[model samples]
Each structure stands twice: as structure tokens, then as C-alpha cells.
Target: MTHFIRVLEFSNKEDALKNFCGSFRSGESDFGIFSVDASTFGSLPSSVFAYWMNPSVGDAFSRFRNFAERGLKAQVGCSTKDDFRFLRLWWELREPSDKWIDLAKGGRYSPFYSDIHLQINWKDNAAELEAAILKKYPYLGDSANWVLHRESDYLKPGITWTRRTKSDFSPRFLPAGCVFSEKGLSAFIDGGSRKDISAALAILSSKPCRSLIEVQLAAADKSQAGGVANSYEVGIIKSTPAPDTDAEVTERLAELACRAWKQKLTLDGIQESSHAFHLPAALRDRLGSFDPPAIEAELARIQAEIDAIAFDLYGFSEEDRAPAQASHAAARTDDEETDADDEGEDEENAALIDQTAGLLSWAVGVAFGHFDWRLATGERAAPPEPAPFDPLPAKSPGMLPDGAAPFHANAGILVDDQGHPHDLARLIEEVLARVEAPVPEDVRRWLQKDFFPFHLQRYSKSRRKAPIYWPLSTTSGSYTLWVYYPSLTSQTLYTAINDFVEPKLKEVGADVTALRNKAAARTRDDEKQFEALQAFELELIELRDTLLKLAPTYKPNHDDGVQISAAPLWPLFRHKPWQKVLKDTWAKLEKGDYDWAHLAMNYWPERVREKCKTDKSLAIAHGLEHLYVEPEAAPKKTRGRKKGE
Candidate 1:
């Protein structure tokens, strides 16, 4: 380590290594250079040309007792460079399943399994994306392949993670039929056998592996520009300490991981946003009872088992596992205290609290014709089963065909009125009636007070608060019209007015007139009823007028996605945090910041039209390709035959 050697590009690395080792043996350099192949690269990626080699990188590699990076095929995935043009949320596209592959662009921390929300334009082996890259840089010539680095590895089973290690070193298992991203770096072992994969997943998701990876990223960070790394790429991971897992230990770890994965599905299956979601876990078999704490505890128990086996495989002493053990114990204690607080209520009431809520949520989904009624009603023979990495379904099993749901509102508009056939409560009751689950006594009150917030929380995942069922309520929350997000239209408010509000208002008006005509004979109870009906009449009239005023400008476009589409109706959402978010979004929309939205074009046609002429993205978003006016060239001078005449 006395002197350093820096050389120009060599024709052969092997020959260079031979000459370098010979120089040290011949005493030309004081330092002894024994082996100079992968050892020289240290923890640095062999593919990356890093000359800022630190001595500690080499020291980290020496600490790995039995593992080598060569056993795994770790590589970076494709980068579209312009994601907006090529990517869409799976639901955003029509007939998405045939042309689009699930895109694993690493997201929030979800270990073992997570929903892959994005789909790439992989219609013709990424032809569209490749053509775009080539057009952007024509000089790239035949090497445009750099844009899709190691693309041949697409749709292969691997362990994937965000190349930038955040506070949590969460790595998820990526099964076949996905194209990874640069951010979603992946590694696969030879053959990718199920047993080997299970073992790898077990190790990578363990606490010990998480600690090691973080330390490696910290070391790698020092070599980056300004001593901060934007990414924890392949090299840092390859250099992290790994166990030479024994066969028996491998099987045990895989068993625990497999159990943990299924438990995770049970947890996520209740979630409205997860791909694994089918029926809520508690209601999947029957809508009776389930202990949420117990399910969580079982999953935690499995995770602990995985960590224990992984720690032993890594040859860690009792001291090394103590901190993690203590952490798990503390978590368990906290969970026990929380569980004990749940008073011993009867099973039926317990079911009413959340188990029934889940069933009702599913029932509402059925009423809206979004979820499968058969699954909730037990008319369907079997529950939907899902693999960890199956292609996200365009229409999942148990979901009813588009026109088949009996309770689906004709115009996708359901009202709070008790009189209407398409009343939200009436349709939801229809679904609940088909199933044997305990229904809340007053469905209308639940829909008015609890349902939207419950549905909003269920559907809101990551940055998207996309509740498919939206409640557009009156100022006093006296009336509500539920609009299905997928079916919002310029005619929706008109449908609400023509179908529900006017009829209810007319009935209330007749009652008020009758009460006044019999004024002298009216009882004290009759007077109170008349006054209440009068106030209700006023609220209904205001709601109707507001819709009439807003209808001229309101345009609902699903392509704007749920949030932007819901922004214009911000005043309707009650004091929930989502209302504020929608309000801010609306403010931005009015300011011409979101002119790309179809709603924006409807709201401010002239402003969006002008933007469409200059910005192709806006034009594309609005489906107004004609608005992208190409600049006309200047006319050339004739000069009278070049003055020779």
C-alpha cells in the first residue's frame, strides 16, 4: 500500500494484471500486489469506470467470508428518459393488458411484495420507446441500446429495489412479465430456480441484510460527487456481506418467506389499491368476524422466523442479533397493549365495526359495478388467488362484466334520496341483501356520513387519492349525489338534476303547501315537520341551482385521472384533508398550471388552446394533435438569377 499505480486504457486487463504483479514481485514497487482481477474493483461495479477507489472498499470485500458477486446477474434496466410519453397508470389506458407490461419503477417501501402500478409501452418489444430515444439522439447510431441497458433480461424473475437506498432498504421479489427500470435495479441468480429465489428473497428482506446494505451504501456515498450518492447501484449491493446459505437453512428460510408472503397478500388483499386485492381479507370467506391484530401478529411471527434463520446463516453471533431482537420485542409489546384496549364486544357488533365495514365497502363496489358481487355473495365457487408477480389484471376475477351488474346505475349517478331507484343506499342495500352479511340498519345515514371517507381512505395509496365513488354533497351535507369516477361526464350533473333532485324537491313543495293550507288545524308536531321540510326544500333548491350554474363549465375527463377530475368539485368534499388537496389543485388548474388536463381545456378553452399550439405534451394530453402547430420556415430570397442576368 506504499505506492499507487495509474495506467491508461489497456488492450487486455489480464495482461496488465500480470505485468503489475511482476513489478511488485521484482521490487519495482514497495507494495505487494498479489491478485488484481475482481479484487481491484473492490465493491465498485465492474461495469462502471470508477478510479476514486477507497481502501475501505477492498476491506469490505475481504470481510465477506464465502460469497462472490459473480454468482448473480445484477444489471440496470431500461430508462425511457421521457416517462410521460411512454408510461401510464395501468387503469389509464384502454385495453392495456395486451400491449403494456407491468413496469417496476421502484416506489415506496414494500418488502417481499408490492403492487406494480405502472405499465410501459412495450407493445412491440419496446419499439416505440427505442424509436423515441433514437430520434432524440440520432448520433447514437447503432448503440441506442444504452437507453435500455441489459434489456434482454426483461421479464425475468429477480430481486428488485430502488437503486437509491432510502431509510429503509426494502427489496421486493419481481416475478416474470415485468420490465424493470434504472431506479428499479434487479439481480437474478443462475437458472432462477424457485428454491434459490425463495432463499434470496428471505435473505434480502432480513434485518441483517438491510443493515449490511445500508453500511455499503454509506461507504459508496463517499465516492460520489460532493460526497453524496444519488443511487445505491449494483456494485454496492454485490459487495455487501452474504451468507453461503446451507441447504437445510435455505429450505427453512424459504418456507418462512413463503408463509410471510401469503400473510402479506392477506394484509394487502383488503386494500383497494393493491394488485393482490380481491375481497377484504376478513370478508373473503364469510362477512362475520376477524381479528386484525391476530393476523398482523402471525405475519410478524413469520418475519421474525425469517430473520432468525438468515442471521444464523450469515454466521452472526448472539450479540449481533440482539439489537434487532430487542426492536422486534418492543414492537410486539406495543401491539399487545393496543390489542388489549379492544373491549370484548359480541361477535355481531365486532363484525359491525370493521368486518361489516369491509363487507359493506365490497357491497358498495358491487353496487357501483366495480367489484365482483358474486365473490361477496358466495355465489362464486372460489375466492380469487394471486401470485406475487402476476401481470396486473385489466379486469380481475370475480369482477362482473361491464353491463352485467344489476345494481349499476344507468348514468353512473346515484343519489342520497330514499325515493329514487338509483339511490346510493337502495343499490347498496340490494348488494347487501344478496349477501348474508349483517347490514347497517340505516344505509343512507352511513353513506351520508361514513362511506365516502371510508372509501377514500381505502382507495388512497401512495400519492394518489383516487376513490372511484365520489360524493358531491350540498353545503349543509343535507343532500349527496354519488358520481362514479370512471363514468363522469358533462351530462352527469344534468342526469342528477333531471332524475333525482327535481322529483324530491317537488314532493317536499307539495307537503309545505298542504301544511300551510291546514295552518289553524296543525298540531305542534305538524308545525315542526313543516319547518324542517321548508329548510330541506331550501337546501335542495340551492344544490340544484349550483349544479345548473356549474354545468356550463364543468367537464369530467377520466384521463385527467381521479384527483384532477375531482378538483373542480372541491367545495363538495367535507372537512377531510383530501378537500384541501383538491382545493389547491383547483387553484393551480385555474392559474393555467394544469392546462394539460382535459378539464382545463373545457374550463378555459382559449388559454389551453394557445398552450396546445406550443406544448406538444399538453396537446397530447388533450387529444388535440392538430393544435401542435409546427413553426413555418422563412421564405428564401430569389435575387434575380444571382445577378448574372
Candidate 2:
């Protein structure tokens, strides 16, 4: 017998099985089918039992056998007597090879010997077989239901058993009915037919029709709640179908479009697409169709009305406007130019006034001094000359002097009308005294003098020297210490001035030298302090920067006079020993101990202090106390247990 079979691949095995089983009963008579088994189904060489049942089914079966021989030798050879026993049904009527060929053609008659070839149609029976399995195994009911339905429609309506000619055997029919007696009975139906076939298949493959007696029995059982039981409950809440009204759908679509537009706009900013898509077509068209000339005319009319109102209120005329506005603008420009010129002149005048004031103040503070000399009687006066480089003569004839004044000379003793000594030594002493303790007025007058003592001496000598005796006085005078001798009075006067002025000049020089040394030491101290303060300030800035970098969210509160708390990872300034040092350093800095603070803090604070002190706003904002660190006590050591214990 020959059977027509259609094979299909489904989205999944369950879908294939559902198609097969759902068409089980109705498919039987239409297709003229008797019984169906896995052995009569289309070949699926991927399954092991199918390959064994239909070894020569098709090209795929031949390939599958070759693959199995090489790959699955252990599984194929391990089969027992029962594995090949499925062929025993027709074993008495046909050889093993003939039965194999028949099964490969979907349970049709073998074509090897064309002895009375009968047409057998088993497509409907195949679906019925799937449904019967699903009835036996409820777990597979849904899947089998679909496969039964699919198979009934895929094959012709009635079962037609036909003969296959010799050499017509193929593997396509092997998968559907192979392994029917063993695993196929429990096997899931593979519902793999297309949609049109699926629903028709379900109606065709329902359970077999029952006799009147069987129907009566089923009715009695149902009345007793035993047969054809309704096990499912109807759901109370019914789902409403989607609205089909055009307006409702249109509103929904508009809402969705708006939401999508907003989402896109938020993500990508306001751009052409967002704006264009957001507007309705009608609005865009209306805007595009607007009349530019008409709008412009309306605008002009409004502007004219405004102009008329302005003219009525302010007495302005269109024709008189231009020249008057220009004149007013020119006047304003001229006024501004004049003001700028005045400002420039004022600046220059102020500068000149400041210069004049400074000059007058300087002039008022200068000092003046005067001197006059007249030589003693019998003393010679000499013209002004450079002083000799020799030491002053000794008091004793042969005693060497300890030190000498290089500029000392035997000049005449002179006096003014007030009896002030006009000797060179006294004059030198007075001049040196003025140099050392120079009043501003005295220094000024001294600076004004032309030849100084030389001019005075010339005047003194001309006034006091007798011409005849002057020559004798110049050559014959013996140097004497006593001023009582008129011949030695000039030598005595010069010597006494040297004696008095030299020591005081030395004293003044020493005082200046000491003052310079003290100043130098103070400067060094100041520099050290400044350097230390600078380093401290730098460290503080670095610490602040580090803190800022670590916690960007931190913001100092100026109103609250306390340092902000630091992040957990950042060590507070107060936690370190350096804190105490900083505090001490800060205190010293406040007290003008710049050097002390610099050394203690190990950084410059002068820069920091100057920055803080000069800016009152900054000083108050960053409280001065924030710069200081509070002292903390050292940790105590724990005592150990006694050695004896």
C-alpha cells in the first residue's frame, strides 16, 4: 500500500505536535486511513529510531546512516532484540528488507515486487495516532492537539493507501511513522504545518465518533459529573477590545506623538526636527501662507498712530526734527569734550601744585651758619694752601707722638668780636662737631660756604699781620704748647682744636658704626621672619588647595566663624602636632614676631598676614582664628606589669 505524507518544520516541537493531535478524529474517514504509528510518519533521520526503521528512506537517510556509522557506532550496535522487534507485525508476510523499504515510504506497500499494488492513504490515521497518544498522556495534550490538526490538513482529506513502484523509496516518509510501537507511542506530536492547514486539521482530527450506546453512557456519566467534565472556570473580568473610533485613535496617536516629541527634544535639545515635528501640519501651512505685505501695512499704520500721538504730546514735527536733533546732539558732544579738557587741565594743575608745595617745604627746613677770624698780634697769617701730610710737632723735643692729625698746621689764633677762638684747631673742632651733630640749618650754611676755613684765615691774616714783623713771625717762631706766648699762640690754638675735635670725631664714628651693626642685625632678623612666614603661608595655601581638591563641595561659611569640617579621608589640621606649632606661630606673628613665626611654622606668614590684614573684607571673611591651630596634649604611655610577677 502507498500513502501520501506531507512533512513540515514548526517554530517549535510543541507547535508541530499541537497541529497533529488537534485534527485526530475527523481526519480518519476523509483520508480513508485505518491506523497510524510513528513508523508510518515522514522520515526524520536526526532521530535515532527513525534512522533504524527507515535505513534506505531518502538521500538524507543514507547520509544520516553514514554519519551514524562513523559517529554513533556504540549506540547503534548496543541495541537488544527488542530494538528491532517493531518489524515483527509484518515479519510473517515480508522480508526484513521489504518491511524496511515499506516503512521508509510512510507505511505504503513495498515496490520491490509489484505484487498487486494497493493504494493506502494513512495521513488521517497519522493524525489520529497523535491524538490517541495525547489522550493517554495529558502532559502532551496541548502539543498533540496542534500536530493532529496540522497533519490532517497537510495530507489529503481521506486516507488513500497506494503502491509505490520499484526504485521509488524515499526517506521523507520515514520520520512520521518510524518507531511507532516503542518510543513513538509516548512521543510528542510535531505540529509543523502552515496556518491554513492548522485550523482545518484541528476539526478533522477530533476524537472518533461514538455509537448510540456509547453516547448514552457518556451522557449518563456527565450527569453524574464523571464524563466530559468541565474543569475550567470562566474569568469574571473580561478584557475590553481596543477602541476602533477614528477620533479616539487620533487623540491617542497625538498624545503618543507629543510624548515622543518631548522625549526627543529633552535628549537632543531644541533643533529643527524637534520643532518641526512638534507642530501640526495645518498650523505650519497657515504660518507659511501668512501675507507679508498685509502684515507690513498693519505695522506701518500702528507706527503712524504712535508717531501722531508723540507729535501731539511733544510738539515735534517731522520736517523740523532732523536739524534740531543734530544741533542738540552736537551741543552735548561739545559739552562732553569741554568737560574732558577741563579734567585734563585740572590733573596737570594739581600735579604742578604738588611740586611747588614740596619745594617750599624743603626750603623752609634749611639751616645757616657764619664765621669770621682776626689773627693775634705778632702772629703771621698765610694765604690759603693745601695742608701738609706731616704729623703735628711733638710737645717734647725728642718724644715721639702716639698718633698725629695729617691736616694739622700752625695757623694764627683768630677771634671774632664775641671772643670766639679763631684758631685752626678750634675751627676744625667746631666744623667736625657740626658735621657730627648737624642741624639742618647749620648743614645748609656749611654747604653754601666757598673755601671754608681757608677764606676765614685769609681775612684774619690780612686784618691782623704787621708787614715788617710778619716775615719775622713766619720764619723765627719756635713751636710752644703754651698759648700765653704771642709767637706760639697760633701753634697752641691749632694743636688744642686737634686735641679736642679728634677724640669727639672718633667717638661719633664709633657711634655710627654701632648703629649700622644693630640695623644690619635687625634686618637679618626681619628677613628670617619674613621667609618663615612666607613658607608657612605657602603650606597653608597648599593644604587649602589639597582640601579643596578632595572635597569640591566644601564651601566656607563666612557668617559662621569656624573652619569647615574636613572630608573623612582628609586629616584635620587640628589632629597633628604641627597644629600647636601653627598656633604658637600665629600668636608670635600677631605680636610682630615675624622671625619666630617663620621658623616655627616653617613657611612664610608675612605674605599671608599682609594679604589678610590689608583686606578688611578678606580678614573678616576668613576669620583670623581659622589661621591658628589649637594645642593638644601628648598621649600617655601605659605601664608594664612588674618583672617579679
Candidate 3:
């Protein structure tokens, strides 16, 4: 009987070509069919498990060193165990902080280059963070959840990848001076080795590594939920075969990878959220061509070179490379479908939209005094262009110093109503006029309707969604008041009510009354006008009442963060998804799920104060350490004389 099974999926049962320990035929699919025998497993290094698939594939493994056996070993990054208390977007902090260090959390599909926007509370090498985590987890070293590990490798240059991903196994070259998160796994080369970092990155991020990792994920991953996603965990990576880094091929791959990384960062020069961000690529004042297509073309060329050289280093001939190449081709198609980095932009006129929206958002930031307006008109020198591996900047290049912003929204309030002095549309226009850029014809409508959703998408990372510019609007969104998050206080909502909503309601009321009391029998147009005015009047009244109802007790604390602070006003958020997120967060806050939040102390002082006695972290978080009472040591009892020993 001829017996042949698929090496990956095991579908072929007819053709038995080879029967040795390491024998297989490339199937029509991207995997191979192999004749399996029980004796073949004895020749492999890994457990008689799924990672090797079948013996023919395992033979490939036996010939090479896996990551576990190589100089570089996959290392799991730290888990905050409580992200909200320990992690924050870099821009959220107002100034350069020694307390917050660069954190490499998994971002989008970009490879070779890195995108690290998060900063962790690694103050004093995370002394307080570990203490806080230990207070909660208690079984820190013994259990699954750990806050800190491998402290010696914290800031060393290594490679990183998303532990959980819907896309294929993609990795990036992480430079020195950053701590990686659990979801963002790291694999560092042993510092004593002669292995080059850039060369290793090129090899590991190539098509061969991606396909091999995909095979492992297909067999072992269930944490990716039911989707086409997978968890690229430590065990799987440590068991994968490592390609031989031939010295000549290694040098070429290193050069190309570094070039690719640099070009990729250059495209991000306009990206406000990236470490490489300096000036908008669309800015006319910049001296170079910032063509997206050109940048993309160069990156593709560089990647092609990297992949070809990587295949050579792996000792693959044309036929041997075929399946991996096919697999990678399919992975690219899948990545395009799930690319959230570009906001699902698939040849969807993305660049034009990005330029328009990013410029407008930056303008809004300038109005809030978050960014320096002087740079838009060349009044101040623009910061020098950033390189691929510059130390993370203290602040984004053109940001105004912390307190130097003069035209920040008055009382932390800006209204959307036309003719209002603090109208957001006017503020945007003033900003653009300085740069001599033409304002969009529908700019006001865009701010009211499109801007918040886009801003929410832009600022969100690692499951933390907090848009700094919040729009507390009426039911129909005809009127919105933008509240600058940094300047927000408990009284800011009161300002929105007394200064903006109340005056608008008064005008709406007068218009409604004037229309109803018209002497002439109302024309059709007048009737329509009367109806709108009446609806507006009622809506304005309802919006005002809701704010007044909450004002007496709605004390906001910024340490609770923009999301939690705005959560109390969830009903006022016109964006339904944002409203729902805030709504759920509010529920969590009320239910003690967010007890670490300072707002919890503000709302439920007794409960938090009581917990302060038990959970020292919560005590420290609330600045209520004085309330903490350490549990008394158990009575020594003198060991009861051990029954006369």
C-alpha cells in the first residue's frame, strides 16, 4: 500500500514517492506531502509535537539551529498586568520625563522599521511599578501574570513582533533604549556574540521566516480568537529553524535592511504619532520631494533585495523557494485587507485624505496651543529632520513649550457655532492662513461631522482609546463644543453650559417665538423654519438640562485620564462608538473595576480608602498612603515550645 500524508495539512494519500526519514514532495498547495514513519521523530531535536509538522520538515529543523539553540533566543516582554495605570501614549505627557521611558508595543504591519509611541512608567527601572504589580498579583514569579522579567535586557537593541496578530509573522528592528510589552515580544542576540543586529533583522523578517512561523501558528495558536489571526508566542519562535547567515549574504542583507528602515521612517516624517515625525510631508516649505509613490517604490525594491538574499542564506534553490514565496504572496494579500495602520486604506485615495485631515488636526492642535503655530509660517526654525534611529524626541518637533501657548481655547472651550469668537472652524482657518494653505470649502461641516472619528482612530493604540479633543454636542450634532483635554477641569462643562449652550438656546428660543408670532399666515418656508427652530430649541434645552443635572457632582480628575474623565459625560459624545466605549468605561469605573483611578477616590472615597489598607498600589496611586495600614504579622506564639521539642 502506498501511504503519503500532507506535511502541513496531510491531504495526500495516494503518491508515495520517498520513504526515508527526510523525504517529501511539494504539493500543489504551499506545503508538502510526506511519507510518515514513527522512527523519523527520533532524529529531530523538538518534542514529538506539532511544531515540526512531519519528519521530512523536521529533518530541515535537525540540520539547523532553532532560535533556542542559536545565539539569539526569543524573550517574553513584561506585562503591566494593569495597562491604564502604567502605560500612556507618549504625547499625553506634557514634557520630557525621566519617569516615562520608550515602550515598544506592537503597532501596524511595517517591518524593518519600528513604530513606538507608547511610554511606560519605568521610573527607577520600574521599582514602583513592580512593587505595585506584586501587591496585586502576589504570586508574581510563580504565576502566569508577571510585571517585570529579564531586567538586564530592558533597553538593549533587539527584534520585536506583535504577539497577537491577524497578519502574518512580521518583525521589526528595535533599537536600543526601549522596553517591550508582552504583546510586543522581543528576541535579543546574546551581547557576547559577533551576530549583527541589522543582518539578523533582515533574515528573520524575510519571507522564509514568515512562512515557517505561520506554519507553527497554524498548529499551536488558539489565543487569536476564531479569526484568521494567531499568537506569535515565545515557544513557537524558539523552536523555528534559523537560517545560516552566510557572511557575504549577511552583509548585503544588513545594508539593505538599514536602507529600508531609513526610507520607511522618511515617509513617516509627516506622521505626528511616530518617533520619526518632524514636518508634514505635504508641507511646501520642506526642501525635498515627498512623493508617497516614490517612497513606496523604493521600499518595495529594498524589500525584494532583502528577501532574495535571505532565501540564498537559507540555502534554497528556485524549487525550494517556490512554496515560501507563494505563502508570502498570500500573506501580503491578507495583510492589505487588515491594515489598520492606514485606517483600512486600500488604494482608497488614502494619501489625499491623510494630508487633508492631518493638516486640519495639526491646526486644531495649534489652536489648543499643543503645537507651535510659529513654525507654520517660518517664524521659528523647524526642528532638524529626524533619522531612523534618533533617540526618541522630548516632544514632537514643532510643539509649543508646555505653557507658551497663548491662543489655547478660552476656559478650555471652543464652540462650533458660526460667528462665535472661539469657533473651531475659525481657529483652523487662522492656522492654515499663516501657512498660505487654502482652507477646505466644507471645513466647518467636516469638523462637526468627520474630525472626531478620525482623531479617535489616530490617537488610539494598544486598546487604549482617548481622543484629546472631545466634542460635547447636542442630539443632531448641529452644535458641538470642543473641550481641550489638558485644560479640562470640573468647571469646564459648566463653562460649556453657561457660556455656549445657554446663549445658543436663547437665540433658538427667540427665533422659535418670533416665527410662531408672525402676523402674516405663515408661508411654507416660514412653517419649515418654525419647525426646525422649535426642534433646535427643545434639543438645546435638553442638552443644557443634562449638563446642569450632572454639574454638582461631576468632579473630573486628569489622572483618571481623558477617557475616564470624559466617560461621565458619555451621553454627550455624539460619536456612537466613542459614546459606547465611554459608557462601558463609566460602568467599569462605577463597579470598582477601575479602583486604581483617582476618579474612583473622588466618587467613592470610602471604598477606595478602605482598599488602601489592603492594596498598597491603590494606596500609592491615590496618594493616600497615609490611609494604608499594613496587615499585622501573625502572632509568633513562641512556636508553643514545639511540645517540649
Question: Lowest lDDT 10-mer window, candidate 2?
Answer: 232-241
Q: Model 1: per-residue lDDT, tens digit, 340-443?
A: 11111111212233766676777777777777767666565544565655555666554555556454646777777776777778877877777656678988
lDDT of 2 at 623: 41
The lDDT per prediction is 0.66, 0.24, 0.71
Better of 2 and 3 by TM-score: 3
Clashes of 3: 1
Q: Estimate each model's TM-score.
A: 0.70, 0.11, 0.78
lDDT of 2 by residue, 291-410 (tens): 334534553443233323322322334653443233223322222121210111111111122322222111111111111111111122312221111111111111112233212232
What value does the lDDT take at residue 234 in candidate 3? 83
Of 1 and 3, the candidate ahead on lDDT is 3
Question: Model 3 RMSD to the real structure?
Answer: 5.9
Query: Alpha-carbon error at 613 in model 3, in Å?
Result: 1.3
Top model by TM-score, which number? Answer: 3
Instruction: Specify the highest-lDDT model's number.
Output: 3
